[model samples]
Target: MNADTPMIDTTAMQRIGGQLGTNPAGIFQDGNGRRYYVKTLESPAHARNELIAAKLYQLAGAPTLTYINTKAPEQIATEWVELDKKCIAHLSESERKQAQQWFAVHAWTANWDAAGFNGDNQGVVNGKVLTLDVGGALAFRAQGDPKGKAFGIRVDELDVLRSDDGNPHAIKLFADMNADDIKQAIMVVVQIPDEKMRRVIIDNGGSHALAEKMIARKADMAGR
Candidate 1:
């Protein structure tokens, strides 16, 4: 874990709102009085996927909510944001373009939850578009089941990308990303230490074949 990542202390956390997905989450103050939204996960797969997604986004220089792992409740704490809007209507043309480009990170990670109800999973913080809730990434299905049905849009789906009524901008944005952009994003994943990466996969009950498949998929995407 990075030294700067915020680990949750249950005694210091307090529930502030409704649950997020199957996890019960809420706002909490850290030892330093900093506030964060913490979501608890019962599944080891969710935890592992969350951590890996966060690290990949950070390494790729993309905007995502910062997350820290916790023990007791098996939770992850993300930086809190207030007063976020869904549609890109509020963003300037330049910001919209940047947001479109930044969405390449999602394509790289295969996050199907990128666009929530009215863009609930994405928001503008400090005048920048930041992607949130990447727990739905990497794996083939919603539960991160390798043999499960594919959940999100595959990287190769171009036509259906713009068909989303909820947040067509997301699909359109991702569709605009070229192979090099995706390759650049996946390059960061390739840079992670093999031991560390393998440990995360093994600890999460992921098989060696699954890991190899993930790597191979990224490599194939880079080549296309």
Candidate 2:
């Protein structure tokens, strides 16, 4: 990671690393010597969901992941998801480990959801963890309103990118109904760790806070 950018704290890393248990996602190194992968603790379905979301963004010429959903034995079918140069996947063991730490810290602090839609940036050029992607903000869970309960889906805008300094920026493209629900959805997206990511989403669409009562709903079996 960069000198200016924050590095994972040793104590915090030791805590989360123990929780990660195994490294199901194989390792690879990025150009900058960083490594990354979806957490092994995450189910294959969840990993595939993010990969699919990344692929959709790729199809739209947006910056996202070139994710493959298959196992090592089925590597031959690895799809060619041509995303914007900014969205290309950077798989590396070091990057993945660092990312896992970041995700764990953010989850503990944010406490929004278990995963909190966290993703890591592996585009570091030096020793710094590059901000290649904006994380946080989920599709639907609860409207911010103290009294309202609703849900929706979201898509990212094109402006989100990996900065020269390696900060992940974002632009949220929301999709769903329920005014309060949408507002809550907006909150999660805006809560993204990097201010640039929040700004990107606001610039692309807009921002708002929930006015109704907050209500949590059970996610469908399909998963959020």
Candidate 3:
């Protein structure tokens, strides 16, 4: 569903999975039997941040869980799609082929945690690669884009690839992808207008101030 959809109440969502993280977050099944990983964000702004990131992922056509608009401002939910236990580095070469879009999406959002030595946020499902968690993305990188170089990738004294900013080791997964596809993914976000972004925030229980922040962040990414 789009961001303009109404927020759903958690009252009817039955707990299905075990409690996770330090918080009381859980996997819940809605009345329709759709499961979602629901968690209370650190703050309302963070909730909006996650929402924006989810939308960006959706816009890029990244294979990811669907972000839900919970009625609680500090809470968020993502529709769960079962994936194999393999982590980022363990993905087979074939599964990695379509990973470029999400990688570019991560860079534009400054999701350093998705890369680096920590890569559990992603895995494979039926041979298709997808990222699972991106709660910490969307910090926004304004300096370098269009060329999309904010991190370096090197091998045998040769620079092979560069991202907006991720660990050289972790982000190299994107190196073998079609550059045009990655650029197109980044452009999907860059093309969103301010009014639409504001509507997205307001429709999702985010404050006007939060919408303003997202607008500024979007402008920064676009201006670059």
- Please name the candidate that would achieve the greatest TM-score relative to the true structure: 1
Please give, for residues 82-117, the per-residue lDDT of candidate 2 as tens digits. Answer: 122221145355543333333212221121221212
**Residue-level lDDT tens digits of model 1 in 1-224:** 46565557867566556655545777876666677777767566666667776665665667788776576545677776673554555656666656665454565566665654344566677777777677766763334455254533235422234455555655645555566655554465455555664555565556776555555545554555
Full-model lDDT, candidate 1: 0.60
Please give the lDDT score for candidate 2: 0.27
**Whole-model Cα lDDT of every candidate shown, in order:** 0.60, 0.27, 0.60
List the candidate 2 regions with Cα displacement exceeding 4 Å: 1-38, 72-224
lDDT of 3 by residue, 1-224 (tens): 56486676777778878654433578888778878888876667666666776765665566666777788887878777777754767877666665655555565555554543455666777777776766655542221122134322211111122443445645566655565765575576667777877776577556676567556555555554
Clashes of 1: 0
Each candidate's number of clashing pairs is 0, 26, 2
Using lDDT as the measure, what is the rank order of every candidate, best first? 3, 1, 2
Question: What's the C-alpha lDDT at position 125 in model 2?
Answer: 43
In candidate 1, stretches whose alpha carbon ends up further than 4 angstroms from where it belongs are 1-6, 19-23, 83-89, 140-154, 157-160, 163-169, 172-210
- What shift in Å separates residue 76 of candidate 3 from its native position after superposition? 0.7
